[model samples]
Target: MAREECKALLDALNKTTACYHHLVLTVGGSADTQDLREELQKTRQKARELAVATGARLTVALRDRGLATEERAEFERLWVAFSGCLDLLEADMQRSLTLGAAFPLHAPRRPLVRTGVAGGSSAVAARALSARSLRHEAEGDFDVADLPELEREVLQVGKMIDDMEMKVNVPRWTVQARQAAGAELLLSGASAGASSVGGISVQERAGPCDPSKALAATVFSAVLLVAVALALCVAKLS
Candidate 1:
């Protein structure tokens, strides 16, 4: 039963590593996030379940009396690998969501409004319109639709990481080193052999902010100013 649990744990860790790699590749591309998001959810669920099944038994599994020295070492190695893969995956996914949230909720492609002014008036109006659009674009009008889901995902991943850390007193190695050793083991298809585990410092998650009322007021003022300027220009031309 212990051996079966070990194998299943190792397999789950491998799955996590694959998911992390896929996440890195997907995020670096222009592909839609729907698939990536689903995969993340599934992988996280598997990881949480694995932790529940194995965390309570880790102490016995790692004890000198439980298994041979070699077996205990191997178990530690897999734990290290699992920790590193999960750390990298969760950190990267959080970053992607944070950056994604900075984008405008709905960007409508709008052409500049044309006005019949044969003089410097047309130039002035165009400049005003461009400036207004640029300002709003910089304000970062985010979509709250995905914000709640992202926050929930982040919280779940964090809890999973924290739970494991509390359960296992692994070495405080760097994430890069753990990942490197894990990668080497995965590539060589050899027995796991490593001593490493590290936690990343997660940033405080920000809730969604609504700037619609302020944005609407800004837009209204800009439009009114443009209309007034255009009317003045037309009056002067006449």
Candidate 2:
């Protein structure tokens, strides 16, 4: 491929790969999760295979150019390292999946209001939901002691459990929010990847799934790509 074309393809693939890695976290229990896992397996294979193929083609090209023996060996070694990229990607995926599973509930409840509304059924529903949400706010039995006797009796259940869960909830909520946002970036990422060429993208080929993860995986992938691209640029300039 030409330079720009190759860059675009690589970017699209990277984004799609990141998307799947992020998705494995939030989609673990869904019916479609296995499909996501299968897609992930396929993606890792394609990446490894592509790296090998590219390395082979480049080696042949360099050999045809009458490159020095030592230089040729070095080039082959560098390209061979691409196969290990899959291993790194798989490790990141596993780590992110574990972090995602830390929540007590596998799935978050459907949010009360996607956008808090002020009128109609949404307004009434929002009010009702707000009341329910207040239940999460009370920190201890003391906070609920002011309620009716029957309400207080029911509230004691939280005393038994709240402190233990509260510790996890704080950090988990933050992680969950970021994963949701990152997943959004990844899903829409395919179109963003395609916007330049005005055609189908790598994400489309892989198919989309319900999404979320990879603070661990996402950051690593992004950093690695930037590092690799910079190395290539430096090599070309020299």
Cα-based lDDT at residue 146, candidate 1? 52
- Report the C-alpha displacement of residue 104, candidate 2, in angstroms: 16
Error of 1 at 149 (Å): 3.2
lDDT of 2 by residue, 12-116 (tens): 445555665665554334333323434544554564445334434543544455767555444444333322333445454554344333322213564221333
Cα lDDT tens digits, model 1, 108-206, are 573122222335687766765566457645654433355577678778767877877776666745222325556865865543222111111122234
Off by over 4 Å in 2: 1-13, 27-32, 61-87, 93-238
| Clashing residue pairs for model 2 | none
Root-mean-square deviation (CA) per prediction: 28.0, 31.0
Q: lDDT per prediction?
A: 0.59, 0.45
Best by lDDT: 1
RMSD of 2: 31.0
Candidate 2 total steric clashes: 0
- Write down the worst ten-residue block by lDDT for model 1: 195-204
